[model samples]
Target: MENANDGKYVHINGNDIYYESYLHQQSAKETIILMHGFLSSSFSFRRLIPFLQKEYNVISIDLPPFGKSGKSRRYRYSFENLANTVIQLVESLHLTKITLLGHSMGGQIALNTANIRPDLVQGVILLCSSGYMKKSKPLLILASCLPQFHRFVKRRLERSGLENNLRFVVYNQSIIDKEMEEGYLAPFLKDDIFFALTKLIRDREGDLSKDILNELRVPCLLIWGEQDQVVPLEIGKQLHKDLKKSKLIVLKETGHLIPEERPEEVFHYIKEFITDKG
Candidate 1:
């Protein structure tokens, strides 16, 4: 039995990237790369890993500034830079023709990566993706732009705010236990994490445009929680409408954390999509 918790680190783009690989014996040809969203780590996919690893090799990555991965004050935090680092990681591992699975912000990074190297990516799976949604709040953007405000923003993300965010994103409040909070809050224990996150928000380029989606050559699957308040279901619908080769699936009684809220359904959807041989 593979221990999904064990992880390794690799140097990519001058930073150490942490990732966990579940290499099942039966399925070695196909690979699935899991990318988590903002304020999240690879740990978000804990429930889905075992289910997916049953028939396919799974690799979950910790994007820097958010997980156990190394962070630096000087590194660029734009989505383009993040995509480049992911590409470098893929090349370093000699992984090819992968199914790129991303959640929330990770979805944007996945799309960006696929757009850059269609040759390496075979398909894309987006869970409550963000790039196609409404533009970010101008006030927040302005706040992020001012370097002096970074500390203020950092101070504002108190435990209460974190708890409130958890409640807002996960429809089933019962699952918001101590363990879950601790897991999600672990990365913040590192010094100056808020500064890193602020940099990420401020440096990110504009959202992924329809023009970019139209140019995507690989297959895409957009999965959403019908009750998602963060990104909303309409965004997923719009993405499906815009992406010529994409399909959408919305789960009931769920929120933004579909993978955590309904892992089995997500597993089935992904399995059917990947196994259809389309």
Candidate 2:
């Protein structure tokens, strides 16, 4: 029953984006839009979505080039454009005032979406966001500029390498089971994946600066794994300090893959966040 969720597709920007929706009997006054991180898909939330759908409607998206979603060589992969596509998806599906839940790179896209369309987002939840990663740019730019270097990087994403990379994201290594490995690696095996990724990295620009963070008038929640190796705990601490009306919760013994590593804890925090009347 783990992979029972059947996903549907929406056409946008000449791409067929994939998403899974969990509907509740209650009216859809509020909903949660889940966005996965870099090199990840909505399958990351498979264990967590059931808990969320119990009380409110929940939808998880597979950002193009990263899930069952279709990819195009011509589609721009910048965060802004991706965020706009999410907005279009929301509008097309008639969702209103959603709480944008984004993990890592998806968090950055959520922040960008909230900034661009504050009217559509009721709140924002960040799971070890990447906007504060200042050291990543130079390395990304270097790799993007060097074709050979990029190829070398791509080589590391082969089957075994992909499994290793998946294990690297979580503090608990036991969760790197066959299902998890396959779920994360399947997207990369597609023919156009590398090209789409190249475009994504080459087009990377801007960050959720203090000005944009300050301008975010909606409620924001910051969740971090105490031992997150990828984005680090310091970034989360700094992000919490910068946001005026945000609550910060750091989970002990957790890693960047909080949803997979500790879904119960994640669900608890998110449920409280959405229900809070303050």
Candidate 3:
């Protein structure tokens, strides 16, 4: 689960996008673009990638304004922009017909990417995906406009403590080790993350509507943690029903961090999915 390999960054939409590539021995078979959740980075896929990279070319990204990626005030943090950025990053690498595998907020971005450019994306895998959430309310949007808003966000994060956030995401606390906490906390050590997060507050759009999801032509594989508190399993059920071509799998006793909690099972399912779909 450690970042054993040093990742590189690519300039996209006037911002530097950070990504790590794990190539299989013979990568002509399949390719996967892995995206992490809100407040997460490519590190989230550390365990999952080891198994995936054994068979598929895996690329994990740190969505802008998080991790090592550039935190520019001018960079729009909207989901649409982020999706486009992902597509541009893939095209920049000259990779096409790849699958988009995402968790939580990244799941929304993956869906948006497929919806935007299905020619580049052949499949989508969503784990504990975010769905049906509305845009930021007027009050929160107004609050983000304030000069001291970034400070407020910084203080709130400090007050909550990273341990609490980690506990909230996982049903089992045994996995909350020193390395895991440090991996997640590393990106926020700099003060600039606060302002970028504040901008994200006003920049991010709502999750896709059911109508839009229903029209997606790409085949989808949705995995949900039964005990997830962040995004309930019911959302996954609804997502399964919404997408015309999708299969949902529920992992009991698991929580929001599906990759962290069930890498083996996830990898197994992914293997079966690609083989069956192919």
Candidate 4:
């Protein structure tokens, strides 16, 4: 299961978190923390790490129950708990000035962290982030109301035959190749991981909107894919309006997984943003 790009693991609070650190030898002035989306690992940033590592220290962690990280039966896998875990990781690494970049569910975690600990975070970059959207489709509302039905859907998704279905739901089917499909499906193949995903989905349904976006004192960047189906493009536009100091960049012909589909473009935007701030 170990790849050449595999990072070191650290046992924190009874959980083994898979984390990769770059530029360890150099004296880093600041650190950039990359958070992946739901059902995704630090592997999401595989394409951008080399370019970023050369300049600033780059760190990415696989959250509990995802990737090679430990799965805890004790933890409820809530957003609050995840955010707390991330804060602990930051403290452990002795990172004072950190730029938090999160995609999808990770973005929500970043927003929660900023709201709770503004002093620790310097800036934030959200990619197709959740929150700020209230419209739930009838099917979703029905699934929420019926616990059994929700469980059934979850189980069905984890089946090997449903890999294509899952990929279609997450990304544009036309762009999903064999390798990409395998990468997305590899995580759900494990029973514990699937259970963890269900827990995450339940917790994600709760409200995570923040008023801090309107009063954001720190620099922020919002990147979204124009063809994004999960979070929708309109939500990104709304976030731009909400965050006063935010810059929104929408990549045309891209889908929900912007980092994977448009790595070079996304990397350039982030690199320039961080450099300009300094």
Best by lDDT: 3
lDDT at residue 192 of model 4 (Cα atoms): 71
lDDT of 1 by residue, 1-278 (tens): 34444589998897789999888766567789999998899989988887888878888999888798877767788787898999999899888899999999999999989988899998999999986544457778787778576677567777457789899999888989888888888888755787787777767777779998887878999999999999989989988987888989989889999889999999999988898744
Q: Which whole-number lDDT from 0 to 100 does residue 245 have in model 4?
A: 81
Instruction: Return the top candidate by TM-score.
Output: 3
User: What's the true lDDT of residue 197 in model 3?
Assistant: 95
Query: TM-score of every model?
Result: 0.93, 0.91, 0.97, 0.84
**Can you write out model 2's per-residue Cα lDDT over 1-278, one digit (the tens) per residue?**
12335679888977789999887766545689999998899988988887877767888999877888877867878888889999999999988889999999999999999989999988999999986544247777667666555465467566448767776789999878888877887787655777777767767677778877876788999999999989998988888877777899999999999989888889899989988933
Better of 2 and 3 by lDDT: 3
Candidate 1 residue-wise lDDT at 17: 90
Better of 2 and 4 by TM-score: 2
lDDT agreement with native, every candidate: 0.85, 0.83, 0.92, 0.75
Q: Candidate 3 — which pairs collide?
A: none
The local lDDT score (0 to 100) that residue 44 gets in candidate 4 is: 76
Please identify model 2 stretches exceeding 4 Å from their true place.
1-6, 134-153
Model 3 spans > 4 angstroms off: 1-6
Count of clashing residue pairs in every prediction: 0, 0, 0, 0
Residue 251 miss distance in model 2 (angstroms): 0.4
**Compared with the true structure, what per-residue lDDT tens digits does model 4 show for residues 1-278?**
11234478887766778888775456767688888877788877777777667667888888787888887655656767788888988899888879999998788788778877889988899999986644445566456545455456456665636455545444546656677667766776657765555445554445355565676677889999888888898988887888778899989888888777778888899888888888
By summed lDDT, the worst window of 10 consecutive residues in model 2 runs over 144-153
lDDT of 2 at 227: 90
